[model samples]
Target: MPQSVDRALDVLDAVAASDGPVPAKALARRLGCGLSTVYELLGTLTARGHLVRTPAGYVLGYRVPSLHLAFQRQMRMSGEVQELLHRTRRAAGVDTYFSTYRDGGIAVLAAATASHPATGGFTVGQDTTGHATAHGKVLLAALPRAARLRYLAASGMRAITPHTITSPERLDVQLRRVRHEGVAVEVEECAPGVACVAVPVPAAGAPTAVSAALPLEEFHRRGHQVAEALRQVAAEAATFQGTADISGSTGG
Candidate 1:
């Protein structure tokens, strides 16, 4: 690739990985490039609608979501994964979600809803806090101790609900158990009256997870069944690794 192209891609990647908008100077420092070069690239990217530059900083532009949808359409899931997700949702009688830890947060990749939808309030492409959701906990648990601590500090450990874990020490213990049990569970942590259970799918890299959600009442009554169903699907998903390749194939 041309050097300019390489640098532009670097700039894009840095912005995409950031938790929020990134400034030009910060991009230059992170890319180890001159300020002038970063500025030129930023300008070009912004003109092309690949990035949006504001007083705060540069963020991914509107074009990115369209491109993402195009790529996802192109990267259609294999029959097995789709069937498994659907079957799990049907069997578990709740909403099933496939999410991944990316750029220091949660990305819900896909979801299958039950015929009688519950009030879990989840959707595809939804960004979620890493400290309050079962899927987030699975991802957090996979991180090295230092990185996990840094993320918690950056997140400020804000509580999403009364059940959310706001203390880093308490959450650290929970993350350890997530690792040991190969699963994570949340009881109204992310949202009131909603509960979730998730298991790690490291095969996709970056701590991807699959989860099932239902009402707190149903969860309390049949937590074991829901957990078992989620584990089965997660184990199957753990054998799959093509998602990252598909997502990256279209990258510059």
Candidate 2:
């Protein structure tokens, strides 16, 4: 059986699928639900700013801007995030990347490489487990509570490294620390020799993320220096094309 909240969400979906904002009676009929249920659901969705009404009919709310913002965030990250990765890689002479949380895991969308002791660079479309990488950890740390719970539930607690958090409770402790410190770290979670440091890229008005990935020794030797450059570039990049989701802001 459908749950109450699910029913409410269904009502919203019906309205959203409509050509225009629909009146309550027509909306109820379209949803194949009773008037009272439809009315209650519409009220709830409207209150959440996800649905709205106009002179003609019920429609998606003014906050369609927010949903657009989320879509824009994903696209922005695809293009501009690569720039940040290049900046950090160039400045620090280290491998750098941006990863986003995807399907209960982390996807490495872009990466830049600097010759460190003449090491090779990472390419695009390389996906990894969020539970196993520095970038993933930072993204995990930044997840909204509900999203985080959803990820942990689906991915389950497992050990990919000696340093990896094998339990949700322990992972929670570290994630809390990441939230407070505004950084996430991994000693050997993703690779034994590679240590990484990461930070979040907030999406106040759009899909948001945390950016990370680095080599351990050099990162420690000049982390603050690289990080300062990364932060500056991140800030500048955030202002790009008016596409950056500054509204999805995380307080500095």
Candidate 3:
């Protein structure tokens, strides 16, 4: 690939991978490039509308979906999910999202914040444990059973909360259920008092999952109904499920 464009994209990735806007200098170190190169990349991407400058620093832009839409809707469905989350927050009360595969985990492609009546909570760029998250598991379910078994064995599902599946056996069971339901749930897993319901947004070009997270207390009160709402919202998003290819396979 062209080095300039690659560097520009690297900067964009760094921003997307963070919970908040990231400074150009920090982006420089992570990409193992010089400050000037980082700024140049940031400047270029921002100019092209892929990024924006914020008080926190630089963040992936909300317009990303529209830019990637039409041309690579399949590949860019993830961004549409984010855009949907941002909009759904108005209806579902925010706290909704779309996630995609990244570095053996799920990346937040889009999110809306109705998580609280106020501000200050997990940001849009957060990445959660694949096994622990309801949405994450939905994507995980797409993996071949044989490969899924191996991933769980090595990942050694951790106990994020009492509700989390800490064993391979239990995790496997949950994944099976997710496959059947076409949705996943995180009840106090990944974070205390946090729960999520998710559905797969299948796009062969750029596949991801659509999820809605809420305070655990609220989730228990509304998980079932919200799961349906999530489904409806997903209907508005693109469907993309490419062939299964979990990055690193291991033995179960």
Candidate 4:
């Protein structure tokens, strides 16, 4: 029963992650399950109003929106936190982000680009590459030891850029340094000319991190200032809850 439940949830996640309606066969391949199993689960989910079948394939049902709305409301971060991100953007003169580590993935909840906007485009709903992102490193480092190991094993270090960490052993060392230093820094790791610095928020619910991205030149010159600004925000914000235990998976 537990295994069935996991597969059902996996099906839902796959559908959600997809750009459009997904076929049963595709889902089976994605989940590594037989067609019969996927068809049965899809039927059950569609019947239960958790999925909606379309001409092309299946998408989330109406019920999913309400659930998403509810989750958003539950995670409605404080105005102060939002303001802090904005302030950080202005202070650092770069694009700023508020992210949470959930389900073994980094979910960008809020982003602010002030007068000095960054060249790269990133925003909410984007599941960032953990192996190449400072925010990802902070959150990944905060995971429980066992879960972190499981996540690392499952998440192959895919190289987004030539500078991206591709070795698990090297990444493990980097994560330890991030934890010890209480900060994460990435220089041209995710993108050629983009650099990022992140610091953990230590929120009540989930492990949250705040980050600022800038051009490589600016990041090199004022990275410490950005980190300080993020630390100030983390210091002043009231405690909040939403982050749950680490999910034993790695992000895409």
Work out the TM-score per prediction.
0.64, 0.57, 0.60, 0.64
RMSD of 2: 13.4
- Cα lDDT of model 2 by residue, 1-252, tens digit: 368878877776677566556888887777677989787777777888888767776788877667755654654554565666676667676676655555445555556765432132233443445665556667777767777777666667667767777777777888888789867777767666666666666542332343444556766787676556655655665566533533332221
Q: What is the Cα root-mean-square deviation between model 4 and the actual structure?
A: 7.2
lDDT of 1 by residue, 160-221 (tens): 88888998889989998999998899998888888999887655645678888888999999
Best by lDDT: 1
Please identify which of the two predictions, 1 or 2, would achieve the higher lDDT against the true structure. 1
Candidate 4 weakest ten by summed lDDT: 241-250
For model 4 the local lDDT of residue 190 reads 84
Worst 10 residues of 3 by lDDT: 242-251
Model 2 spans with C-alpha error above 4 angstroms: 1-80, 102-105, 115-123, 126-128, 204-212, 241-252
Any residue pairs clashing in model 1, and if so which? Answer: none
Instruction: List, residue by residue over 13-81, the lDDT tens digit for candidate 3.
Output: 778778788988788889999998788778878888889998878988866866545423433343455
Model 3: which residue pairs collide? 82-110, 89-94, 94-114, 95-114, 202-239, 202-240, 202-241, 203-240, 203-241
Q: What is the C-alpha RMSD of each candidate to the true structure, in Å?
A: 10.0, 13.4, 6.6, 7.2
